[model samples]
Target: MLTAFLRVFAGEGHPVVLFLDDLQWSDAPTLELLRRLVTTES
Candidate 1:
């Protein structure tokens, strides 16, 4: 699933912006994915 997301973003030609709301209510898996995305992309 994370690979799929990385591919989607990486394949895009234009800049991307992901808007996530109510992070306090986010579940553990979601937060973990976000962390990985940030670390991997940066």
Candidate 2:
């Protein structure tokens, strides 16, 4: 699911911008998904 979501922005001519807000209110699963994305992406 994450890979599919990321592929939406792959191989584009324009710049890709992501906006994440209200992380303080995010649930554990949501936060964990973000952690996984950051770790794998880096």
Candidate 3:
């Protein structure tokens, strides 16, 4: 599932921005996944 998103957000040449909202209502696993994504370069 994460792999599929990485491919979609590849951005070919431009840039890709990933935005998330309602963090107060988010679960632990969701937050953990977001943390990994934020730390990754590509």
- Write down the TM-score of every candidate: 0.62, 0.61, 0.61
Please give the ranking of all candidate structures by lDDT, highest first, separated by commas. Answer: 3, 1, 2
Q: Write the per-residue lDDT of candidate 1 for residues 1-42, one digit (tens) a residue.
A: 765656666754754567898999999999988888777742
Residue-wise C-alpha lDDT for candidate 2, range 1-41, written one tens digit per residue: 88557757754575456699988899999999888776665
Residue 15 of model 2 has an lDDT of 42
The top-ranked prediction according to lDDT is 3
| Model 2 stretches astray by more than 4 angstroms | 11-15
Q: Give the TM-score (vs. native) of candidate 3.
A: 0.61
**Poorest 10 consecutive residues of model 3 by lDDT?**
3-12
Clashing pairs in 2: none
TM-score computed on alpha carbons, candidate 1:
0.62
Report lDDT (Cα) of residue 15, candidate 3. Answer: 60
